[model samples]
Target: MNTKIAIIGAGPAGLMLSHLLAQKGIDSVILERRSQKDIEETVRAGVLEQGTIELMRSVGLEERMNQIGYKHEGINIQFNQERHRIDFPSLTNQEVMVYPQHEVIKDLLNARQKEGASIYFEVEEVELFDIESKTPSVEFTQYGERYSIHCDYIAGCDGFHGPSRKAIPSEQLKEYEHTYDHGWLGILAETAPASEELVYTHHPNGFALLSTRTPTLQRFYLQVDRTDHIDNWSDERIWEELRTRVDLGNGPELQEGRITSKNIVAMKSYVCETMHYGSLFLAGDAAHIVPPTGAKGMNLAMSDVQVLAQGLIEYYQDNREELLNSYEAIALRRVWKAQRFSAFMTKLLHPEQGASPYELRLQESELDYLVSSKAAQQSLAENYTGLPIEWEKGKKDTILS
Candidate 1:
């Protein structure tokens, strides 16, 4: 089969890229190793940045989100048993939607289906070929049927472990990585949210975040050992850690109910330089990763595709290569910004194990300053709500390089 672009993976980045390209009469096919049910059911934390929400609205995919998603204009950063609210709108004229990532996936999937877009799920042995050439392609097997797609470009959205990133020669891939000692043990409970807005807590014990998935379901996280297993954290132990770290005295106790799901997400920040090789362009987790602290993962992924879609659109419609040429530099600027914010937020909330008393005091002072200073709060609010994108649609000038 011949197409303009061959997209790897069916995650947010891949699906969104396909959708955007379709809007411009550009044809692309998506190859996903997982089934549609699998991708739709994998629950993940979602904190939609303002730009993400706008992008969804622009694409006509925000209808379901508007009908069901919760909107939060503020988040509480708690310390010393006190919760301080950072009003995003008041600080930065922005707000975030507390929609789950899976829900967004469902929306994107549905939209693509309605548009008759081709997305192949449950494909095996996906591989790329001749990515450096003008004529690139992808080969994969679906249910014992071998298929090859000849396309002009390949988008490596297959995620961190997917084959796309590894397709680049190791000698050409420069990686920067920082692995933290802490991880987040998260659970989804069938209970009402304890707080109306998200709560991020820092305590001597560790860090905990309280977020709402739905009115009837609550999501909570507690900092734990990076190597800790789900077997070590029973339902009771999970609740105890959350209460110990996040409870506010003289306030409503955290609502509790049957725990439905549990996951342990390791803390790490990683960035792959250039984010592309030849005709292969990487977006989302295939390119970089951030700890979930700043809620930048999904937003960054979507942003990467937005830039990518713009580049591809220009190449197809206007015969322009400037945007496509500068895609890496453009995506990296926002990726690194997110890395900085996510790292800072992670470090600020979690006390390092075996940190010196002086170091602990300094962290406390940092929090103290953050809470007391408007400039600091605004900066945090802006980053959390997503700083503005530098790329503009249909702008031919390449300021990125």
Candidate 2:
């Protein structure tokens, strides 16, 4: 088949790219290794940067999000038993939507299904060939058959383990990475949210964040050792830790449900140069990753595709590949900004495991300044709410030597 474009992976990044390409009159196909039902039930980040919501609205995917997602203008930061609210709108004149990632996937999947778009699921052997050569193709096996799906371009929206990155020769790339000693154990419960807005709390014990999937359902996480096993923590132990960290005194009790899901997510960030190899372009987690602290991972992935979609539109319509050629730098600037933001937020909110008393005091003092000082709060608010579009413009203009 002579598809104009081929998107590997059906996650938010890949699906959104396809949708955007469709709007620009570019036909593309998406390949996913998982079935639609399996993807819809998965749980993930619930915070939507203001720009992400706007992008969804522009693409007509916001109706379900509007009806089901919760909107939060502020988030409470608690320390020393004192809760302080950082009003996002007060600082940046913007608000975020608390929409779960899975819900967004469902919306995209349903919309695509209605359009009769081609998305191959349960397909394996996904490989990228001649990415640095002319006429790149994505080879995969389905239903005991192998086929070569060719396209002018390939988008590696696949996650960390996907083939697109590895397809590029090691000699052409430089990778930078940082792995943290800490991680988070998250849970989803079938109970009403304890607070009207999200709550991020730092205690002498560790750290915890209170968020929601919907008004009637709550989602939360606790800082846990990277090697700790989920089996070690009983349901009662989970609730006890949650209560100690998230209780706002007046908030509703957190009723525990089946553990649902549990994993120790290692805090790490990665960036590699030359996100493009000939006709293949990398977008989303396939390109970079961030610790969840700043809630920037999903938004960053979405932003990459937003620029990519625009670039592909230019490529197909005006026959201009300028945007396409600069995809890596454009995406990386925002990626690094988020990486810095996530690192900053993660360090600020989680106490160093063995911090000296003086160091602890310093962290608390900084937190105090962030909450009380207008300038500090505005900086956090602006980066947290969304990044400016112009950030991509300057980065894309510089030529790679």
Candidate 3:
């Protein structure tokens, strides 16, 4: 097989990149290790920043999202038995869409299929060769059949654990990492949300969150020990912890229902110093990962690929290498900003295991400041709704020129 680009992974980052490239009249093939059904059903982050929503709309992929995704203007922060709201729309003229991550995958997949995009699923033993060379190729096996895709460029959207990043020699890439001693115990329940908007709670015991997935389905998360297992938490225990932590005193009562899914996610922030190695460009989780506190994982991935798509488009159109050459610096600016915000949110909400009384008081004071200062609320709203993509000029230059 031969193509202009070979995209590894079919997650949001890769699929979105393929769709965007198709809009530019570019041809690319996707290599995915999971079955189509697995990617569509995988549960992940749900919050969509305004930038993410706009990008999807630009690609004509927002029909279902606009119809089914819930829009929220603000989020409630609970601490010291008091609740305060950060008005996103009022502060930043933007709002977040509460749509499950899987739904986005389904929409992207549908659009890709409609465009007759090439995506090989359930691929095995995928490998990249001669990435530093002008012509890079990906070799993999499918159903005991060997195949190779020769392309001008290779996109490493295969995610953190995928082979794409590992293919980059460690000496050429500097990795920075910070792992939390705690993790999130997440659960999905078949019940109506307790509140109209998401609520982030800071309790002495730990941090908790209440978010809605659908009109009838809700998601909840509680900070737990890093080694905590799903087997250690029963349905009743999960509910009790949530109710106690998110207690807004006379606010909405949590409605209990059957928990359909549960899992523990270890918290960490990681980023590779360089996002590209020769003709192979890394995007999304393949390049950086932010703690989930800021809900920037999927949004960051989309942003990275959007920048990459523009760079590739420009390269193919005018034979310009400026955008492609600056892709790393451009993407890293946003990546670091998100990393700071996510790390800050994580530290603010999750108390250290053996935090002293002074440390707890400081955390409370920080939360208090956010509630009392409009400037603070505005800052949070701006970052939460997403900063404007700094590479908009590149996108316009490529698409319009």
Candidate 4:
């Protein structure tokens, strides 16, 4: 019933936070509403930043990922049926790994289990009490029995829909959000990847992306009306649209296969300027969300928890409160930068819902400038590979609460 920290949700942010804390000799309990099998089976795209990849290795959780994850040096940006490649290593000296988020969960969960850490799954009706006080508690049900967890601190890594955020008093929190008019219809199929690197397409029809999950499993996405339903897209129609949107003479031809999963995800940019509200500190999707256009989703979540872990470590190890006090400010800086890049990519690729012909040409002109200018390409490569994060551990003399 009592722990040092009570973490809600077993997703990457929660699990990674616990793992990082454990490595620093802290104790935490994890609570999840979904079953372990469910979380592990849900397939979500992960484009790991260089920092994230190194962080996983630092905490002894890189065995499986290093063995199975795909690495890429850059990505292709296509517009007006012409393709341009941005080389990340040469431009930014970084690379990304294509490892799905479920794999990260599995790795972190397995690491916790091996260390005798406790994670309670399938919990229901979770509620937070005294989140603004030093003595916070999490209440929920499991297997038809009510239970509670009392901890010195509470982490709201439970995501946007979880009780953690809702528990925050609305008067003390400020939220900024922008929901796009279009969404991505994504699929996982058994087929060869359309290219060695990820392909981002800007077409007259809509935006499309080609990504890889495995040697033979390809993940792809297409922009569609936000109101569109999965029922409107058959496997054949989905393939046709993808082919049409991504078609360019410079890239590989479309390869169709048997799709195993399909879903529609709306594009949205959200930021909770208040990541720390008293004893409850939010991370990952609980604090911010970026559209998938920039492949920043999982990477941003990992970084959020990284900063949280460091802050907690400083507090418990040295009794310093500065890092913890400045959690919201530090996390928000990068969150907004990510939102900028994601928004730029979304707006640059997805044509306006109703735009004049001149407005449409302006989008293509920007792409033309990007492809022709090394300075612009370098900027894209830098942002795409990842912006600088505070990778070093320990506190700085400059951080102001």
Candidate 5:
């Protein structure tokens, strides 16, 4: 097979990149290891940064999301039995969309199908060769059949554990990482959300978050030991912990139902110093990962591909190399900022076990400042809704023009 670009994953980044490139009349093929049904049903992040929503709308992909997604104007922060709301619209002139990540994937996949985009699913033993060469190719198998895709560029959107990043020579890439001692035990339930807006609660027991997927489905998270197992937590025990941690005295009691799913995810912050290696460009989780506290994982991936798609479009249209050459540096600026925010949120909410009295008091004080100080709330709101995409001056106009 031959194409202009070979996208290595079918997740949001790769799919969105393919969609964007298609809009510009550029042709590309997507190679995914997971089955189509698997990707569509896998539940993930639920928050859509304002910029992400705008990008989806620009590409005619927001019709379903706009109809089903919940628009949240603010989030509540609770500490020491007190609850305060940080108004996102008042602080940043924007609001977040509470739509699951899988739904976005389904929308992108539907768009790709309508455009007749080529995507190979359930691929096995995928490999990249001659990445530094002008013409790189991806080789993989599907049900014992071997095939190779020769392309001008390859996008490693596979993920943190995928082969794309590992293909980059270890000597050329520098990785920075930090792992938390705790993790979040997340559960999805069939009940209405207790609060109209998402709530982040800090309790002596642990950190708990109250979020929603729909009017009838609620998602909740509780801080737990890193080694905790799902089998150890019964539905009753899970709800008990959540109820105790999120008690705000005056709010409605949590409405509980059968837990549909449960998983424990370790919190970590990781980023590769470079996002590109020769003709192979890394985007999304393949390049970096942020702790979920700031709700940046999916948004950052979308941001990376938006910049990448623009760079690729410029290269193919104007024969310009400046955008492509600067892709790594430009994307890294935003990537590091998100890592900082995610890390900050993780620390502010989840103190280490056996936290000293002073540490607990400091956490309370920080929450107090965030609730009382407009400037602090503004900072949180801005990062939460996402910083604007910094395209090269007039280049943004050129791309859209």
Candidate 6:
């Protein structure tokens, strides 16, 4: 085969896969429909799991991340006007870093250029051919011309919108899905972060999270009704609502900016079984998607690529297909674990209107238990900081490369 792999989507999953495959002397091309400028301008997913940080370090993408990323020791849970801190390091012996997806993409793009690999930006018409056939290749368009890259294998790193899922016969795939009634309206500000650690507040009005991207940049989100449009909230209105939801007695004063971006992101989780057919393999959101509540999107994507990279490396070195066949099962186990965690965290902190009084009290009790019990705190700490990634040799401190 002329190409070892073809990865669609230049997001974290595709880029990371390209980087790792290159390390193993495997050649691959990344095709992304969006321009580099468009990707950098989009804001999403800032928190990084301890496992993800370690993985980036192993793959030579952590120096800049370590220098600029914000390190968070724990998260503060605010409920009933009382604030409780869950010390992540104290309980789990690990910490999370606040780094945006955009920055990660920026670093990956720079690194790929240095390596001179093929990452075509603004490409279109990405398709999967003979996915179930013994030989599979990707067909795409560049510069108004058609092209087909024959590959030994294809890694569908493209996200939820990519062609990986479509390539699978509808009758052969069963997609399970769940959508919540609430969504998040995120905002980025040029002001200093309000608190050192992310604050998740449960208020009668809604939910709020105070997070950061850099020392001088603050990123925050407000939980609102799924039907609530961003048009309903003006800059001043957003500030007023934020004040009401987060008033942590002595929390950092919020400085409002241009309301730089606003959108309602509905929460949902979906997974398709059997992520591979013949020579085609699926990775990241192309195979499964989880809500962003636990900041698991990027982390899980990296995890997916990690497993695939190892499997492909083994295959190239020794013609072993054992790990490759087990890839879907291994990745799905971790994926479901994170999905449950994210769903649990989202509902635990997000207040639902019209909920029974007893249910509301139970939510309070859950919060109280989390703060007052070491066992509960430890559970949150371990998951928050990220449990040791499961690798073939054994669990490791980091899973970067």
Residue-level lDDT tens digits of model 2 in 1-401: 76988899999999988887887679988999988878888878868998898888988999989998888897888887788888888788998898989998988888888887899998898998888776888889888899788888999999878888888888987688998777898877777777788788888778898887765567788998877888887778888999987676776566666666666677888887668878888888887888888888789878888878878888778889887787788788888888899998888888877889998899889889888898998898888887754434554321121
* Candidate 1 per-residue lDDT over residues 1-401, each given as its tens digit: 99989999899999999998898899999999999999999988899999899899888898888988889999999999988999999999999998989999999999999989988999999989998889988999999999999999999999999999888888999899999999999999999888999999989888999998888988999998899899999899888788888877786598779999998989899999858789999999999989999999999999899888988888888899998888898888888889999999999999999999899899999999999999999999989999766674333222222
Every model's TM-score: 0.97, 0.95, 0.97, 0.96, 0.97, 0.95
Candidate 2 residue pairs that clash: none
Give candidate 4 regions above 4 Å deviation. Answer: 249-252, 390-401
Better of 1 and 4 by lDDT: 1
Pairs that collide in candidate 6 are 55-400
Better of 2 and 5 by TM-score: 5
**Residues 91-119 of candidate 6: C-alpha lDDT, one tens digit per residue:** 88899998889989988889998999887
What are the lDDT figures for the candidates, one per model? 0.90, 0.82, 0.90, 0.88, 0.90, 0.82
Lowest summed lDDT window (length 10), candidate 1: 392-401
Alpha carbon RMSD to native, model 4: 2.6
Candidate 3's TM-score = 0.97
Give candidate 5 misplaced runs (Cα > 4 Å): 250-252, 392-401
| Residue 358's lDDT in candidate 1 | 99
Model 4 per-residue lDDT tens digits across residues 246-342:
8776655988889999999888889988889889999989888899998898888877887788889999999998877877777777788899999
Give per-residue CA lDDT, model 5, range 1-401, as digits (tens).
Answer: 99999999999999999999999999999999999999999888679998888988999988999899999999999888888999998888899999999999999999999989999999999999999999899999999999999999999999999999999999999899998999999998999878999999998999999999888888899999988999999999998889899976776589889899999988888999768899999999999988889999899888888888988899999999888888898788888889989988889888689889999999989988899999999999998888766565333321232
How many pairs collide in each candidate, listed in order?
0, 0, 0, 0, 0, 1
lDDT comparing candidate 1 with the true structure: 0.90
For candidate 1, the per-residue lDDT at 211 reads 91
How accurate locally is residue 153 in candidate 6, as Cα lDDT from 0 to 100? Answer: 83
Clashing pairs in 4: none
Q: Could you give me the TM-score of model 4 versus the true structure?
A: 0.96
